[model samples]
Target chain A: MNLRRLIVIGIPFTWLLLFFLVPFAIVIKISLSDPAIAIPPYSPTLELSGGWAGLKAFFSQLDFENFTFLTLDPLYYTAYLSSLKIATISTLLTLGVAFPMAYGMARAPEEWRATLMMLVILPFWTSFLIRVYSWMGILGKEGFLNMILLWLGIIDEPLTILNTNTAVYIGIVYTYLPFMILPIYSTLEKLDLSLIEAAEDLGCTRTSAFWLVTVPLSVPGVVAGCFLVFIPALGEFVIPSLLGGSDTLMIGKVLWEEFFSNRDWPVASAVAVILLAILIIPIILFQRNQQKQLEGDQ
Target chain B: MKKLSWFNLTTLTLGFAFLYIPMIVLIVYSFNGGRLVTVWAGFSTKWYGTLFHNEAFLDAAWVTIRVAVATATLATILGTLAGYVLVRGGRFWGRTLFSGMAYAPLVMPDVILGLSLLLLFKVMFGSMGMTTIILAHTTFAMCYVSVVVSSRLLSFDKSLEEAASDLGATPFDTFMSVTLPIIFPAVLSGWLLAFTLSLDDLVIASFVTGPGATTLPIKIYSAVRLGVSPEINALSTIMIGIVTVGVLTASLINKRKVVQRLKDEKTAN
Candidate 1:
């Protein structure tokens, strides 16, 4: 039995190690190599003397250069901060919209619950890229929104809604809203109604009972939803790239440019390492909280 | 009961409208005759005709289908295995590591994941192309599939497998005959999820795909960068139509099962 268990576990472990872990290790190693101008830095064969010198140079070069450049450089820091700000704002907005929707689903008639849940997830099946692009048609200068507004005499001029920060926020929130809703809905679905009934029987108003009982009970789902939104939003590339204007510089776009346009692999890796570090704490907390919830249920 | 208060009804109607209006507009405008994406110049199927003839778009679509299918299959297999182990196997050396590896891709930012994969390809494989895109997508796609499959595994009955094993069948035979059938639905769902993710992926594909290996999303992105046109709208309309049909079908099937299970419970009681 033990050997069977080991074999079962070992297959996935070996697969992940070979494909996932080793690849990441190679990335870190390549980041430490010198960028060759005439040839690609990643040569199939390592030049013996050049490799030793490159290793030494890599170690010596690993100072505050990349970090300082990322921080002190106005463009870099601005992009990093703006990306965080957008992601944070979008996450909060999604939570605001999704909370009420989830609560409504939870409280709705049992017959309607599944249909409502389907409504919430229906948008998710569509291509994410297509959904993001659809926003352009709705928010562009001559797009549907503007046309409708003009017909209604709401505004004389078309709104400059496309390719802006607002557009980026809208795109991010729209894409991630389902992620926020499902977890919260699952938690709310499993919530014991008797607890609420008890609170009410004790003379707690619906509002007070919701705050004092339901809200506290759904903390795990809230955390899961937030982490789900925040982590991916932080590194979101597609929305910001397609909808965001020049002003909407994000870390993901920066990393893309560094690797593809600038051919700066080392700096991109450094940036990635930093992003990974930023994500570690929240991910660990979210996972721990989720595990505890699972154990509690079990 | 408030008996459907006006405010609640209004919110529900408006929320659905907000979700559906943009999609409707995209669908309607796909038939627009003019090049202008916004203005509906008397309905025509020219854009659909145009879409058919656009070899570039067709090629990208083909590439996307290939990638999605391959990633879905590979991720589903690996994920089913990982899910089985995580839910049913005993804790041992490297179990934690395996779990971490499986879950790590979920939390990692797409940018970081894409960049890391790009660097890996450059260092080890010396090329950025379709294979890299497939590898990067499968990395996270497998994680998602594993999570979904594992949740299903958790609720599964262990005794059925034991019963089968005791009935003079080998473990493999028992798994094939008993376990596989029970988990097949979960595996199918996992595959669908993986397929959608692989198809929707843009950031990772952008970082990994070479010049000739652009996918549909990449093509649409580049076209949008130049300018939005009815052609893109036409493409989106078709894609959204397919997705909507798929989602509605799945939900209908799920609802039927739920109702059947409820009836069974009530009958037992």
Candidate 2:
């Protein structure tokens, strides 16, 4: 490549390498090292000045202690499993809500589709923290939901929804709803109406036609949407912290508490490393779906 | 066109309501005269005034804006360049790794990104605060910007750029005079997205920020952690209003541009 090309590509490449990629190396290194009370918060710093001897010493000191510790602690394992469960259930709920809406948008009159799409995208322009925080008012013990329910005589007392798993589910579904809708809408919009017509002509009922043709075809969008929601919901910090009770055991919350409350940087790093390792399968699958879509478009 | 089905209509209405009700409540209650969040009193703008007078909130707001603007501009530049290189540059060494890096941050969790970036910053600069926050935001925000810009580029009319260069303009001249203008909307949206991402960030900012460099989200987080406050509701209302206005105006501009393009195409034909 020419000088200009080199400079253009080199800048982002170098930046990502420095800021995005290399950081994981540090985390992995820190996770294996012992925690310290000193500056930088971890021990056995690689002494590059002593070159080969320093490298040897650092390598020799590195152990699987942190990873092992993670296994021994039931809290860590429970947090991991709980995060996955929450993410999975929330993804399904988002899909249930979003699919119909997306279908509606896809089937809307041509002029109205843009407006509907804009409405969905508008909430995202606002702060995510604000949106999640907004629910606190409605779900609180003395909040609007309870007041309305009590006034209607639906319940004698308020239902405890805030600071619970249900609240986390609501936050996840609400915040990530757009991610689910947009992808599904795009795929459904491009669906060939003729296929449904053909199916009907071949003796399939309307609902059956939708099931066999429309639903089957929209699977790609559904998968994409699910992964989009599931991946972030798995690692979600703000939602669980704000909405979940103290007993809720999300890995993100656990990691945060480990680093901040306990000041155990190494253990936190190990949690993060393991989290990323688990995410690899889903990430790779998402990447493949995207690649296939691109190729199919071409 | 097929008529809308009742089932579809019902869902669309319910879905939008679910999406909007919490925010509408939040905005409406921001004007509540009472200090208690759930209590409805006479409508008042007192909370907005209170938000303005709060020195800590104002300081954090200013810091947040500075971080956002810088992050947006830097992210746009880097992201635009990266998108251009990826789409047009083509077939470079380690292209797979480059593409993987570009996309990975999008799916990566905020906590991990924040933690790892913090560790990196400590080892490199041993520094924290405004610069660290900006760098951290830019790193992730640029990845998002790249996705937006690259998607725009993917379906771009490359022949226009090719035509400009074919007329003997230099590549840089062709890009500046032709490609940039054509993709300006995408670039603008990318900047806006980056700006908002930085403004909205709480997890990453908390991780990388050091003493005396609290951003608005971090400030809001700390406040809300105590309990919902009227001042925060007023602040959120302002943010929602700004975002709503910005998004509506952008959509209007985009729609108008599309109309004008179609009109021009008709006349040319």
* Candidate number of the best lDDT: 2
TM-score for candidate 1 (chain B) = 0.90
What class would a CAPRI assessor give candidate 1's docking? Answer: medium
**What lDDT score goes with residue B175 in model 1?**
71
Predicted structure 2: lDDT: 0.93
TM-score versus the correct structure, for each prediction: 0.93, 0.98
Q: Enumerate clash totals for all models, in the order shown.
A: 0, 0
Give one digit per residue, the lDDT tens place, for model 2 in B83-170: 8877887899989889889989999999999999999999899989999999999999998899888888888888998899889999
Task: For candidate 1, report its TM-score.
Answer: 0.93
What does candidate 1's lDDT look like per residue over B1-269, in tens digits? 33544554566666667667778888888888888887668989888888999999999999999999999998998889898888877666777778888888887887777777776676668777778788888888988999988888778888998899888888778878999899999999999999999999888898788877899988888897765688888889888888889988987898799899999999999
**Candidate 2 off by > 4 Å:** none
| Angstrom error at residue A122, model 2 | 0.4
Evaluated with DockQ, which candidate comes out highest? Answer: 2
Error of 2 at B225 (Å): 1.0
